[model samples]
Target chain A: MTETLTAPAPETHPRYAIEIDGVGKTYGSGDGAVTALDLVNLDVRKGEFISLLGPSGCGKTTLLRMIAGLEDPTQGSIWLPGRGLDGLGFVFQRDALVNWRTIIENVLLPLEFKGRRTKAAYQRARDLLATFGLAEFEDRNPWELSGGMRQRAAICRAMIDDPQLLLMDEPFGALDALTRDDLNFELQALWPDPEKTAVFVTHSINEAVYLSDRVVVISDKPGRIVDITEIPFERPRPLEIREEPEFGRIARHLRGVLDGHSARRA
Target chain B: MKKNPLAYIPMQVWTIVGIFAVWQACVMVLDIKPIILPPVPKVLGELFGNFGLYLRHGGHTLGNTLIAFAISVVAGVGMAIGIVYSKFLEKTLYTLLVTVNNVPKVALAPLFVIWLGTGNASKIAMGVLISIFAIVIDTVLGLRSLHPDLIDLGRAMRGSEFKVLMKLRLPNAMPSILAGMKVAISLALVGAIVGEFVAAQNGLGFVILSSQGAFRTDRVYASIIVLAAIGTALYYMMEYAEAKLIPWHESRRSHARPTAPSKPAKGPVAQPVASDAKA
Candidate 1:
């Protein structure tokens, strides 16, 4: 608990980007307390794409948020080396782009807040929109765009500041299946960058297996890690890789691990 | 690509014309006494013939209404912000505003006249009293309705509280505030007239009051017509301003009227579809 909110000194673990040592979160104390996460420990390597895959109310989002310092852990300590809240980027399940702002302006919002809304930053936003194929839609309002485009804009907003650690909480969960698949491919195309480490939360096993360097299966209630599977898929894994037998094997195994935990609880 | 304004008027215009035609038809068909409801032509004749008198008093009313509305918008929005940010004010000021607003404003207008005198001061005071609550209540709703993530994103970026308020919170709240303004503007006219009803030298309210004693039905009808025009004008003015200021809002997403420009009219919104699935 003392660890989640504090600005700890830079860590000596150069190989690890984030260190969670017995981190737990509980909403209240004593009789009314609802434990969201049990004491959980995990180490995230530098430049890794890790997914916390679990069912709803499994505290996957809570865990991701604790790392982002949106929620304080009530027990143990999670260390972020030196990339505190300011050095992290967070994307929610909803796009939540300010409807009044144009797409480019929405992306530039973080910079404006940080007093970094310079000419170069504006250009950087344009470039990011271009990367997402939203270049022509820079000045259009969020409502004018499709659901998928709005989500893309939200992603751009997170990345505009070039945050070292990006945390996303089921970012594509609200979209239609087809749109979600399209965004998943688009996201994986740009992500797993060596410069950035991403912590993603999702219940979709296929998505977790497709994009993650490692998929961590979390148990249902008072969430704790049940199993961690290293995805051995090679670099620049194309969208077609999801069709491969090996990809299904990895996905099915993760699903089995999740079902085993749920059945045991049942 | 300039289109003819006369070619296609909105249904509202035709509806208004139809109402006038129906009024004239009813009067002609029934042979109703002018005292009960004056003939449409007679009212229109009086309206056009003595337009200067009506204009003079109408100008007075319009000026006071605008002044009160401007003051209410500034002060009410400020009060809303204060209530939102301060727990103390949310409890004290917001509750007090709702309580005062619930009191019968017509009864309160005479009280304003007693306090501020029979001049425009009392009228303006009444207008502010009646109109300000909507501005405050709606603005508060708007400010609070902002997605929690927007605030969280601000905190994550270490953004100044002031910047988040000005850019994120206020802009997001604009349409709601403007909606309140629209309701307030019409209510403002009602307040001003109420004040004039109790005691005022000149206004549309005064015209209606004085003409009633003389049984000058034409003059009364003319004054009512003038008030209707003014009220309609004020409403549309607010609507047009809402369309202009927050064209990105959903309220403006309906078919492009002369007042509201649609999305395509905005420059260069061609979404690139070829790269929808890829970078």
Candidate 2:
């Protein structure tokens, strides 16, 4: 496991999009305080797809929230060197679409918030919806759609702003296996463009392997990075890639690392 | 697609008609005294005989209710916004509002009449006092009930606090605020009647009391009927407004029946003949 795991290269003039430096987060105060993340350092290069894979109690979500600037780290800072905070997009486990807004309006929320509702923006929103197969349901209320459809609309919304960084916290965790597989493919097609970066958090090792270029495994209860392994799969991976021998090897390797951490904690 | 118009009548209307018929029959069969319980026809006659008097008093009561209801809505929504936006107001003003709401406005009616005089002002004050609490509580709940993830999305987009409040919080709170308005409107009517009972020159409440003093039970029954009609009218008016404003809401959608299935349409098609020519 140690041989396969490699530290991120320290570039001299790094064009990193997001750099987390020794970040730590603690909730509450006095004796009741709980540490969520500690000494977490990672560099997400421009256009890279990374996954934070950990158990439920691990601070994977907290880390993602910190990067998105929704939560503050108690000890360290997340630096997006050149990009503004506005260049961040987030997709939560829940679709979180406003019930009152129609599907098209929900997708256009960020643009509306910025007062950028030009004709071009509208066309772009419609095009994104069409790509995600939600164009027919544009006028319908968010509650009228099925769960998978709502999640797809939510992803469309996050991408509408063309953010430099996309932080997704188990976006398909609530979905069934078939729908999850479908969305995983859609997400793979949507991300890793030369202009955008994505950091995904998931508990499923297969999901992390299938969607990510690099998988950062974290330990439970006060999360800290345990191993960072680069997947050697080529681009445009099919569903059949999960059946390949190398896919099984990497998944078993991740499971072994997770089991070792659990044993030590016990 | 067309259907009978009678199907549009709600079950509630049938129940009301049945109640009136039973009351009329019981009065004729049992030989009950008119003073104790007037027959439905006598009450109807009273209502028609002095229609001008009932209309005048009914108008006064309706005016007072509408004015007070308007005032309570503005003040209640304003206070709710204040509480939602500021933690200080949530802690202090919200608790103060709940404490004040617990004191019966009926008990305070005489004080209002004494201070503001027995004109429309006192009655309107009483209405505002009685109805404002529910509006405030419900609107505050609605504004604060936004999903945290939605707010996070807004923040990630670098939306200003005012933008979030106007675009996200207020629109999301509309259904709940409308629900509160329904409760408040009814309470406002009660408050106005209570105020008229304490001291008033004219109103359905004053008519009922004056008729009771003169032992004109039929007129009392007539006035009671007018008050019930006013309450029902106001409630339905609010319902109409809610339906118009939030057609997407579940409450409005529940009123619609599923549409009929459509027949499949025929289209031109190209058929490939069975061929066995492989080159």
Candidate 3:
């Protein structure tokens, strides 16, 4: 585990927690050309909740994959400032929770992966399940749990190792609107400590507007950020915040950008 | 279970009565001799009269079948793992296995008896030979058909191939393994009985052969019925075990729950968390 670096009184934010500079992903060579994410550059700041919002083929998942080290960027560099990314927790688009493992065991998977398989680690897992309101279903398999609870268990799994940089790809896209809103609130409640930075990728404009501190809108295929909008919402956001005029305004702006990008392509 | 256990007894009674009625009708109506298809009551008397001798032979045959089944299962699973782990071994050994599988082990049972003697070894060998191919093919398919994404997830977690094999591949391959085992169990029975027909002093196969030689047709029918019952028992036991072990598996789950829950959700919400440099 890397210790959090401190700067004198001023908030010395991570210049770029992830500096994705000139990253490119080309599927095949020669006549079969498919550049998924071309020369993509984005800098996520420390403690900033940034959402990579884009159209269907905008390479949002590709960008998230590069950040998570699941896929290597063909062109550029991605770095974690202050700490090397040994503690980066990744939540994939699909739940990816091992179906055979029970809810609490699933939560403890990261610890198991790290070879920290001790009684104390197990205690921590139990505590996490309780904290996340999954205490009643600790022994239930992923298949037995409802969709929202399964996702909650997946969240607990990702956070078990206390990752500093959490990368999620369309985590709530599959949930219904009400569940998604509830999860957004749950996410706000579970926000990492001040030093932690996160990057999220999603297709929903409202989801981007509701959750992120900064929403980076990207263009169509061979994705590049067309605009970076700073969210001006106050901390401790609630479900009712979605009904707020400013929230709707930001959402509308994002929708406009997405529509414009699609129009240009058409 | 929905079909009552006693239903078989009643069904058997009806079948025996109906067959006996037909035999009796032929004897009286057509004035047929009792030699070709003997009187029903006399045949029944003959069958019940030699019950102890039939049981002794049945036990021998079953023992041979069981021995063959156990050996085939172990050898099959071992060979499957070998094939899964090594490309060279798979390429070389798989061809030989398929070739051996195609050859009729029963045709060579006489030669096997000459080499190993007309004792248990020859019968066991025949049974093992018959079932081994089923096990190998099923286990290999099970080992190979593991989900690639699951493997990728394991790799992403830095789990070794051995760990993945034990934790993911083996468990996932269980249904296929059981399917193979079920087939192997039936084949082993056939092999055992067939081997007995070639050269066996004991076993139900020998009993059937002897009964036929003595022109005791009813005794032969009784032995055949006992063999069928044993085969059915073995198959049902395998099915029961499969049900007990993997209730979450789709095949088992369908029997467990008629209607499953819809819209299974997958994972957690995105949150900004401290990235552990050593995660």
The candidate that wins on DockQ is 1
Instruction: Show where candidate 2 strays beyond 4 Å.
Output: A1-14, A29-31, A263-265, B1-11, B250-279
Cα distance off (Å), candidate 3, residue A213: 2.7
Off by over 4 Å in 3: A1-17, A79-86, B1-48, B255-279
Question: Per-residue lDDT tens digits of candidate 2, residues A1-266?
Answer: 11111224355324687888788889999999998898999988888899999988789999998888787788766777545467878887888787678899989999988888889988999999999888888887765666678788899899898888888999988877877888899888865486788999999999999999999999977788999999988777787899999999999999988887763669
Model 1: lDDT of residue A187: 80
Better of 1 and 3 by lDDT: 1
Could you give candidate 1's per-residue lDDT for residues B1-279 as a string of tens digits? Answer: 999887699889888889889998989999988998888889999989999999999998998899989989999999999999999999999899988878887888778878999999999999999999989988888777666777677667677778878987888788788889999999899888888888988898888899998999999989988899899999999989988888766556676333322222222223221111110
Q: List the DockQ of the predictions in order.
A: 0.28, 0.23, 0.24
> Model 1 chain A: which ten-residue window has the lowest total lDDT?
A1-10
Question: How much does candidate 3 score in TM-score?
Answer: 0.82
Q: Better model by DockQ, 2 or 3?
A: 3
lDDT of 1 by residue, A197-224 (tens): 8899999999999889999999977798
Scoring only the A-chain of each prediction against the true A-chain gives TM-scores of 0.95, 0.93, 0.90
**Residue B73 local lDDT, model 3:** 92
Instruction: State the C-alpha lDDT per candidate.
Output: 0.83, 0.84, 0.75
Q: Evaluate residue B238 in candidate 2 and report its C-alpha lDDT on the 0 to 100 scale.
A: 96
Residues B1-279, model 2: lDDT tens digits? 889898999999989889999998888899888899999988999899999999999999999999999999999999999998899999999999888888876899999988999899999999999999989988888787766777787787778898899888887778888889999999999999999999988999999899899999999999999999999999999999988877765656675553221212121111111010000
Candidate numbers sorted by DockQ from highest down: 1, 3, 2
Judged by whole-model lDDT over C-alpha atoms, candidate 1 comes out at 0.83
